[model samples]
Target: MTNIWEPIRIGRMNLPHRFAMAPLTRSRAQADGTPGELAAEYYGQRASLGLLISEGTQPSADGQGYPNTPGIYTDDHVRGWQRVTSAVHARGGHLFIQLMHAGRMGHPDNTAHGRAPVAPSAIAPGEKMFTLGGLKDAPVPRPLATEEVPATIADYRHAAARSIEAGADGVEIHGANGYLIQQFFSPNANTRTDSYGGSIENRARFGLEVVAAVVDEVGADRTGIRLSPGSRLGGIAEGEGHEAFYLHLVKELARFDLAYLHVAHGGNEELLRRIRELWPKALLVNRVNRPLEAATADVEAGLADVAPVGRWALSNPDFIERFRRGAALNPPDPQTFYGSGAAGYTDYPHLEASAASA
Candidate 1:
């Protein structure tokens, strides 16, 4: 039986364990989109995980969705992330920076430039976004011109290059969570008539192109992508053929021979099984809020090569240790999940501290 603690090779990197730290947006970056000072400590504390997928980092200035989320496009952003990568690597950990483009999810007040969010179409998600003022309606984004699409893809390519330069093990294209890539996947969000829209192939084109561009810049072994099939977040409705579209997309992505396919399971067993069969490389399944035994069962049953956890990883920096010893976990405070501070970010007690206190 393959335990969660067993070492596994994903691409060129041999992870120490099978449990990876799923990207969680802590909103701890500076206003300029640079990572905060404590970002290194925050990530390094969880370095015991097999892999660390950093938060949804913007690929460009206009790609920012929420306030204080980090970016990898600028020199300052690169410098800020260098410290984080160094800290993780020093602890013998592998880090993958998630390249995310917010698309229509952006609020003018949230972004640094106050620019209108761009998307495949002009349709607004009809969702509210968090801003400095408070939660506000997301504005209808400006549609990208046919010529401008390439530039957007270039942004991802450049971001991938920057992440590598910052000493990251790889980059994971954030194609999930109703972001830019998912926006293209959603028929309701993307109603364009261009070559990049309409049919399933066309809708999957933008994401594939971005992946190809990143792979071109950084080899396939250092590239990965996250996908959330049939997700209804950010007011997106995939309509019919959601499963078929994702199956096709995964088949096409398989051609790249990328590092891993991180699937945020959205209650689709058939699609999940199909993806596992279609993808030739490593598979990381995110079963949100699932217990340790369930996650371990996923890997043991060959359903996933590894399982990524969110809240447990967030509240327990020594999650692997806790799981190994069956130690009691510190419950995460939902209020402090996203904010600028170390209260809930790094203050969670490890098993040693808990034992000493008791």
Candidate 2:
């Protein structure tokens, strides 16, 4: 039986364990889209995990969806992330910078330049977004012109290159959770009649193009993507053909021989099984809010090559150690999950510290 603690090879990096950290947005970056000073220490503390996927990082200025979210498009952003990469590497951990382009999810108040969020169509998600002012309704996004699609693809490719230059192991294109790529996949959000919308294949085109561009910039071995097949987040309603669309998308993605396909499981076991079959390489599954035992079972049952945990890993810096010894875990505090400080971010106690206090 494959143990969750066992080592595995993901791309060129050899992971010391099969438990990867899922990307969780903590909204802790500087106002200028640069990572905070303690970002390195925060990430390095969890370096024992097989993989440390960074929070959703924007590829361009307009990609900023939430306040203080980091970006990879600037020199300051590169330098800020260099510190994080060095710290993680010092502790023998591989890092993948998740490239998240929040299309219609952006509120102008949250952006640096107050640019209108762009998507496949001029549709608003009808969702509220966190901004500097306060929680506000998402504005109807300005639809990208046919000529502007290539520039968006270029942004992804540029960010992938920048991540590598900053010493990242790879980049995971964020196509999940009703972000830009997912916005294209969603029929309700994307009602365009262009080459990038309408039918299933057309909807899948933007994602495939982004992946292909990233693969070209970085090697296929260093490229991965996260997808939520049947997700209804951000007011998205795929209605019918959700499974068929994802199946087709996965089949197309497999052609590139990418590093891994990370799926945020949306309670569709049969659809997940089909994706696993279609994808012949590494597969990482994230079962949100599930216990450690369930994550271990996914790996042992061969349902996933690795199980990525979010909140558990966030609150437990020594998550691997705690799980190995069956020790107690520190409960995650929801109040401080997103903020600007060391209070809830890096203040979580490890096993030794907790034991000493006891």
Candidate 3:
């Protein structure tokens, strides 16, 4: 059997296949940042992907970054997501919400009450983000006071609890792509002299604390984390050298024995090998925009237990079947990627529909 089609055990969840839908941001939520009514339909359509990691969802009102992105903190938000989880479950797929806190990546205009974004230090990402208006420069975020760090950790914990209440199978902490947690790890974003900055251990402290808090609220078997070891997105530059910081961070986190560790495309072989050595459990790896041959080769080589596909899952609802049959893949339209409605969201056809048309 193809490695991608084989069953893999990730934590307590027995996945039917190694193909998962990687988290892709689609800003199609309500004005209040709650999930849209059609979210259930959207996720249910792609339920064949074994595991579906929902888009980056904010843990607090201030954590919102893009317009119309979902939140997991409020009552209405929980109710909205419950419907999504139920739909995916009915279709036999495991779903996990990717809890993301935007930090300096957020713009005041995009946030709930125009509140300034906050981070580990008083550093801005030195970039612009999409707001209700057009692209605008990121406002200088206030450094999260040392005393307030506990509250931020609580925010993640509460979000994890809410995710379980919403019937999600698990939660993936968004510790990648220069978001809040990644900001703490990057020296360019975090320059504080407190416990959350300075050395590699100190810089990784906030993320570790948040993970522990969430794991306490939700068991380690249901908590997942996504990391980009050497990514420089959102104006974040890893001045501390990616290999040292991530190596130390993964080694520390390995002790928790969480559900799984999902890594993005930028990690080096040595770092990945180190992670695999330390983390003796499930590992989900995303190949980003790489070709199918490269992705399949990586899976065949056992670099990752599961290989997640993002855009392919978005454009092809039956991505697994299409890949299994070696059929053509539907190209996703970049224009409708972040739109409001179902134009490019859930309208993508499955293999049966395509075959019937042909």
Estimate the TM-score of every prediction: 0.98, 0.99, 0.97
Full-model lDDT, candidate 3: 0.89
Please list all clashing residue pairs in model 1, or write none if there are none. Answer: none
TM-score between model 3 and native? 0.97
The digit string of per-residue lDDT tens for model 2 on 281-338 reads 9999998778666768888988899999899999999899998899999999999988
Query: Which scores greater on lDDT, model 1 or model 3?
Result: 1
Task: Please write out the lDDT profile of model 1 over residues 128-229, one tens digit for every residue.
Answer: 999889999999999999999999999999999999999999999999989999999899999889999999999999999999999999999999999999
lDDT of 1 at 245: 96
Per-residue alpha-carbon lDDT of candidate 3 for residues 162-208, written as tens digits (9 for 90 to 100) = 99999999999999999999999998888899888899899999999
